[model samples]
Target: MLPFGRVAIIGLGLIGSSVARAVRATMPTVRLTGHDADPAVRDTALRIDLVDDVAETPGAAVIDADLVILCVPVRAIAAVGTEIAPDLPAEAVISDVGSCKAEVARSLAAALPDHAIVPAHPVAGTERSGPEAGFATLFRHRWCILTPVDGTAEPAVERVAEFWRRLGATVERMTPDHHDRVLAITSHLPHLIAYTIVGTASDLEQVTESEVIKYSAGGFRDFTRIAASDPTMWRDVFLTNREAVLEMLGRFSEDLATLQRAIRWGKGDELFDLFTRTRAVRRSIVEQGQDDAAADFGRTHD
Candidate 1:
């Protein structure tokens, strides 16, 4: 069990609700509370017994709580942090599950006091949004990155890691800048590309649009599934992580042009070599257990 006396989760969205449910499954004795800006969500959470108690706002949720998790959108991190900053318990540890870490850390630092405020990004989620979409096994066997700011207490960081570990996540430490840049390429860029291609396909003429949807097999269908992810959440991610994503996109465009040229010129050797090299990378990832063909379908469940 975590050393935390109380765990308060703000914003009962998909990620928040998933964590809340997972905590209950993992630690039944821990005192848990829920808060959300929307009253309907709070009421639903209460009806479903997703939390022991429900609060109306961020301050009410964190009062007397040892661990407070901000599980709202990335854009609202600062505002939520500011609202609960003054009322935060003196020894409490504040953390977040926002996708973008650097922006969240900068905002929370200005709002909270000299307490431990660890910015975390649990690399697990689903295309679904809202409270009903959450599940108890969302974080199981997934990676959770903690990016502790300078001056954050070591004990507080360890306690936070313990909490995540109890819920079956592999905890890893990273600098906020590094986390943001890496995710920009891996997560953010992929989502952006998915949304863009899906949008393009939708904008095709009526006949072509129907054909595209009808013929969508593994690749295009996979993009569609990713593109179906929460729009507001993704909009906030792109807006906040603009610089890193833009830089990555530029490089991606250059490589895409090369691949396009190769395909147009029937350069079979270049295509074969590129595919072989990329296949090796996939093999290395599989050997390290980062991915498995058997589990590819399982990722969609989260």
Candidate 2:
């Protein structure tokens, strides 16, 4: 269990609520309070016993909190940090669950108090959002990357790392720039590709639509699942990590074009070679235990 005295989570969405539930389940002695911009979300969290107390505002929730975790969309994180900054107690450890680390870390450090701001990203979530979609084990066995910026206290980072470790996650420390670039390829690009393919399919005429749905198992179905992730969350991710994502997308498009040409020319050898190389990448991921063998070439999580 974490040794935190008081922990407050802002934004009672899926990630926020999940953190609250995990903390309560694992560290029952710690005081937990929660608040969300949406009053309905706060009420729902209270009703579900996800938090020990519900605060009327971010300031009220973070008051005297040894750990303050922001679980809001990336775009809203800075504003929320500012709102809670004045109420933050000295030596408090502030952190976030934002996907894009560099921008979030920079913004929060600028807006929040000069306490310990340890930016983290938990690489686990479902397509669902909102308080009702959260679960205590959502972060179990997941990778939680902590990107503590310059001037961040070592003890504060360790405390946040321990907190995630207690929640059944493997914690790793990374630089914000490295985290942004890696996730741009591993996560952001994939999500963007999924959304594009699904949007293109939806724009097709009524003629082949029925067949598209019927034969979706050919690979389109997986894209549909990624496309269904929370729109607001994804929108914020892209906007916040624009540079890294664009750089990755340029390379991805070139590779995709090469594959398209190989298919058009009926070059079986080229296709086979490309597939074999990609398969090795999958094997490497499984060997590293980043994904389970049952997840199909590390394309899906669980």
Candidate 3:
């Protein structure tokens, strides 16, 4: 059964496009309406048939939608919410794909006031962007966390959870603040470190751009891939999730300093113990099906 009769998507970037494709693949009968702020993206979405209809504006897209998913950046959610509020159906559920949940939940509630708001974060993506980068299988076996605020309708939350499951995602519910703090360490901090490391490598006097690219090891290369993610989206994530990100970042810096002192003092035992423990963490992730045990993270075609 289709959880939503008519679905509206605001934003036509990778995640938005993926949602469209995934929905079309899994629920061929559901009517889809999509609107992107960029004309070029709207055209691309139409060219590729990403949605059933390309709306001229946010308000137009959600005119009669039963479920509206905002795939815009975290900072823009409030503005988008306000934009669509007038045309939004009274009983329509408003949700989002923003990584930062706490602020977004607050923003949507403030902007819409009377709508059933349930914010979600699909903990899935590639180091890619644009409408064409989407795939129907992007959310397969991945986690989609719903951070529905207090007083949200129970059935609305359940419908949204079921919708994500239909799109191939495993669903979990968490408080918005807890979601933000957890993601700060799992996602936001890693992206920040990647961006910094990749930037530092580019500015190194001894290493030319060509040399850096040519000698990029798997570790550095992976960091570069993550660093290459959409800057605008990540910028909003950091700005909105600043408190949690900074807290996690401070802990990370302290740990780094400890490692630095250990290396300088020839504390091989300390290094070995940390590496061993970290290796076990990786093993646990693989065993839990969070990642593949295959070499190169199963990128190889073997």
Per-model TM-score, in order, reads 0.94, 0.94, 0.98
RMSD of each: 2.4, 2.6, 1.1
lDDT of 1 at 288: 74
**Which of the numbered candidates is closest to the native, going by highest TM-score?**
3
lDDT of 3 by residue, 189-266 (tens): 999999999999899898798888988864788899899999999999999999999999999999999999999999
Q: Per-residue lDDT tens digits of candidate 1, residues 195-218?
A: 999999888776487788888874
Candidate 2 residue-wise lDDT, 1-302, digit = tens: 45587999999898998998898888889999999999899889888888889999999999989999999999999999888888989878899999999999889888974778999999999889999999999999889999998988788888899999988899998999999999999899999999999888878886477787899978899788889999999999999999999999999999989989999999999999988999999889888876777754456554
TM-score of model 1 vs. true structure = 0.94
The lDDT of each candidate is 0.90, 0.90, 0.94
Q: What's model 2's TM-score?
A: 0.94
The pairs that clash in candidate 3 are: none
Q: What lDDT score goes with residue 129 in model 2?
A: 91
Q: In model 1, which residue pairs have backbone atoms overlapping below 3 Å?
A: none
